[model samples]
Target: MAANKLYIGRKVRDLRQANRATQAQFAERLGISVSYLNQIENNQRPVSAGVLVALAEKFRIDLAELSGGEGDRLVSALSETLTDTLFDGYTPSLQELKLVTQNAPGFAHALIAAHRAYRHNSEQLASINDTLGRSLAAAETTPYEEVRDFFHFVDNYIGDLDMLAEALAAEIGIGDADPGPVLSGYLERHYGVRVARATQNDDLVRAYDPEARLLTLNPYLPAPTRHFQIALQIAQLHAEAVVDSVAAGAGFRTTEAYEICRIGLHNYFAGALLLPYRRFMAAAREVRHDLDLLAARFGASLEQVCHRLSTLQRPGQKGVPIFFARIDRAGNITKRHSATRLQFARFGAACPLWNAHQAFESPGRITRQLAETPDGARYLCLSMQVSRGGRGFRQPQQHYALALGCEVSYAENFIYADDMDLTNASAYDPIGISCRICERTQCASRAVPPLKGRLVIEHNMRRTIPYSIRPAGDAPQS
Candidate 1:
């Protein structure tokens, strides 16, 4: 085969396995000998044009699937992983990466998994110190982080669970209005579980007595919170099978992780039940994804509506691909989910230049920012403050900034991006994953030096940043 000839043995093997056909069966269907098929599948020979046509005709496989999407994604992910400081900047050539992706995809995936595990351990150690890592290298990942990684890999979308929640919503006659009343009625009539409000002494946001068939919610809790708690209870009581089904293959590190994942799934179902996908997507389009309007229409809080918007990635009926995160006053990410290519840092705070931190200062108002990542991806980010706990003077309000953002490609669909100059590079703030990992030295907000570069401290001279950093191999500055 010529170098330019197409070799999609991996894709061919995938299609054959998908159809559950042996090499002989597949070869016969394609009107080819088993030996020739074997050669093609093993990349010993290029797939002929005739074989491509035969494949489309027999298996109805889209030729586009064979055009290296998964390979490209694998290459990109592998490249990103290898560029981490842990790999010492030893990035493989693009051609080498392509070979790994196409010829040894399973091994490539294993490498990615090991890299993720390594990154997880590094993050855990960063929180404490390297001393803990030296002795207890085996037990590096925590339960919360393990579950978070599972969701992160899945793009925070559970297809079957989403569908199940949508179906339950429809079956219960819940629509683009308050789901609380309907959910309460359904619980009482079907499960004989009566919903009630708890007094101050209850000191719980939500409590359910299964034996008594009672669900007690904090009376002072926000309406959306109350409804969410009710729906979560419904998920735990009725949708355990679906939750367990999703949890079974999640590869959780501990029982706590498994249970926490179930809660997360139930919370997902609750959100789906409250803001049903079809109606929410339609309303979001009508309003151009205005968070306040969507909140009012769906009877959800700004945070709830924003969080729900990120999970609208159904197979055919997808909405704007977005990332949603919640951060506290101290910059701790309380909740994070993203359907976009941009991923949150597994440990440490987000980039200081990101607008999410400013949301705390401007409470009850939406802060809009045009931000670009180190990878050159731009996003239209919206952030607003969310407050919890207001029962008494002693109960101080817990403030969190909820950030909702989408890639700049979808900026036209967002009301927040209306007046921003999306084309101008200067309009966007340069943000990165974290200070320790970020390579941008020009940032005045950088608290520490980057992990990849060698720091050069000048005793007599000081730039805007404390120290100058250059790539490891670069000659010393004159």
Candidate 2:
């Protein structure tokens, strides 16, 4: 199969930064003019075959990627939108696409907006056609989505609250020792609250009685979880003003969104308290981001470690830009944050081909995936099943898999990805955000075709997939 013209600006930029070569030096090595290199890095030009061979020979990059960078989000959306099979066999070249994005950005945005609206309207129409006089209301964003977007816009880091948590953690001397007792003592001394253990019969994980000045914790929770709960309580009580101010500044539309955002801020404070930025970052660098080692050294759970890793965007002393996600047995995404370019689907379960789905099959073992998305960006995903909050065999436990991944550009920073063959393009399992927005035309496990994709049907020619997707005016693939 012939490859289409790929816009791999981000990958090229990453490779150049990884090698620490100036543009002039890199251009000299690639045998291209500095201006041409700049255009390629900025995604204004398509890569030539000679340049591809130079990237392969000099940089060991197989030149497999699509357009991505810190450019306009509309460009990314428009690029993904154009992948619909309705476009027929004609694909705009990289230069032409760039021209559209640059010259008529509003037009590009209008096209993408139309595509998204079409998908939503199509769903509503299907529901309406199924029943007589059934009017489907206009879709509205949920409070959960509002809060998630709030966090996303903030880079999932509350600088003031994080600093406060770190300072309080230092004051309480949170080291390798048990933090539960220290945090409990701080609450007692400062707030005049009594910390006691809740009986096994108690259903609440934590209960605070203001009239009696008592804080009770369930005995069943693990030590790390107990400490986390204590830290969260402290964040609510001590950092109330800061968290409130941050939540207020986010200006969430709904009251429920504001409240949820407040809770999320408390979570950030709690995690920061458990793992101070500088201390945890030093340890993470020392261990090369080994999750187990970091967890043991910091007395944190694996899920907590993954969450903390995603928020390592501490301006100057930053760690690898990692993406973290958790999913239940039903494949519902419980938590997701991406400091990288890979975006999770806004609705529905993740793509089935993602590695997190298989993490449950092997309980304790770490599952790794060299996966590529429809945009041609690649990631190194690591996942493992985690269980928490169960009292007895009959009692229900919260079971989920936590996945930590970053682009292969930063793979060398992770110890788990040491043995991964980054140079092998065929090793990657093709995946997507979701089937509706996915651009793949030949996927055997595609739940549904691209939203507006045209399909070719034949009764006699059956293949791995029942129907093949093609451009509307193009002949069917044989």
Candidate 3:
């Protein structure tokens, strides 16, 4: 099959129009001829790698957008354009289609659409045995919901594991050692299981053979990943009671989510046991939540430090009720949770104007903002970009923005608040959460109407913002 080609002409056009740039103006900014820019926008010429990189750098747009792999609208359009015979007889429900496009966008563009043409005329053959009208099991299940709920229980925090791993390593005099050897030694000493590599009949990176009391680990995983997996296994064994107690009565459609949740909870327990909540919280307060210092002291990753910061909200010893979230360049919410009353959109994307996205451009630099809505609710946000899981010369690193924020009134408690520039009444950046969950009436960043509002577009008497809306269930214009 031919490699899937991305035609981002429409996106280029949309962005150009949104920026109010004429073709000649855009061409000059791109350091290209107007005719060349026109050809690229019209799909007469493909965007070169050099030009694509330049556009990403100059316009502050994500490379994923140029490659056409990130946004829902673009993915959905690509899926529709690639539909073949297999999709002809039965039209898919919008939700199922969306799931495919969002989860396996590259696969859909490369395989599903190409296979459709070949399978167009083919049909499922009738079965020989007559089993007509037999009732079948329900086709839908909510495994994702179960997983989501499980993560929600922990508020998506996993700081405990990092502390435990560090302490354990220290005790064994392997605190600064390679993870694979350290984990292998720890597992052998604690579980009486030997770490071995199995080449046949196994599809997992790590698995425990209960019959032999042996733990099999894939040799290909990096040291950090290996250590994490082993620690997670130990956590499951030692923290079963803690996890089951928390997961009790949680509804699950499929056991898969529950199983994954169990593993994740075990990892969290491992970190907690290592750091111990009381000691870690004390250290965190003492350090003013300096992430690098915390990471070094606790032997945790920067991501782990930030994640742990959100879980300091235990009753009777409650810390700040800050909201935590991580986002990629295209504004995909990789993780999110809140201890406050602030709610996020369960579906759809977050607001693009948030400081989290801006952190990607100025990596390693902290960006602080105080945002308010038209309704007078205010938040103080602190965001920074961090990278994960890449090493050596050529490996690709995953970059994400980590943000912590709280209600405006509580902002003074944080270290960043000490800086007058960040706390200045007039200097805060104006931003919002995604439109669906935000109730701000005058936001210029709104991409869609708030969930139930009817758009009121009056061209002649426009507001400062491009869109206006009436409350849901109100009368429509004639």
Leading candidate by lDDT: 1
Which 10-residue window of candidate 3 scores lowest in summed lDDT?
Answer: 119-128
Query: TM-score for model 3?
Result: 0.59
Q: Pick the candidate with the highest TM-score.
A: 1
Q: Say which prediction, candidate 2 or candidate 3, comes out ahead on TM-score.
A: 2
Comparison by lDDT, 1 against 3, better one: 1
Better by TM-score, candidate 2 or 1 = 1
Error of 1 at 255 (Å): 1.4
Q: Please write out the lDDT profile of model 1 over residues 18-132, one tens digit for every residue.
A: 9999999999999999999998888778888899989878877666445423244456566656666777747576667777778887787678778878876666667675565
Look at candidate 2 and tell me the lDDT of residue 400.
95
Q: All candidates' lDDT scores? A: 0.81, 0.79, 0.62
Model 3 Cα lDDT, one tens digit per residue, 1-478? 5444444665677778989999999888889999988877766677787788888887888665356322333233334333322343344554455445544556654553344333331221133144345432222324554465456544454433444544554565543445456656777787787877656433356788877978777665554456666766767665567577655545554577677666656767655544446667778778776667777775666666677666664433555667788888777777766765344444568777777778988887888877664334577777899886434455566889998787777766677777655456576556655666455677777777665456788878867777787655568877
- Candidate 3: segments with Cα more than 4 A from true spot: 1-141, 153-186, 194-227, 241-248, 373-375, 390-396, 421-423, 459-466, 472-478
lDDT of 1: 0.81
Q: Residue 146's C-alpha lDDT in candidate 1?
A: 72
TM-score for each candidate, following the candidate numbering: 0.82, 0.76, 0.59
Q: Which tens-of-lDDT digit does each residue in 1-478 have in candidate 2?
A: 5655555665677789989999999999999999999998777777888888898788754333222232223344565566665554666755676667655655875676566666666667777756556644443445776687567645677789888988888888987577777888888999988888887644578888988988898888887788898888888899999989988997776798899988888889999999998899889989999999998888889999999998876644567778899999998988887877687765556888999989999998889999998767899999999997668777778789998898999899888888879999999999988887677888887887765556778899999878877644565466
Q: Is candidate 2 or candidate 3 better by lDDT?
A: 2
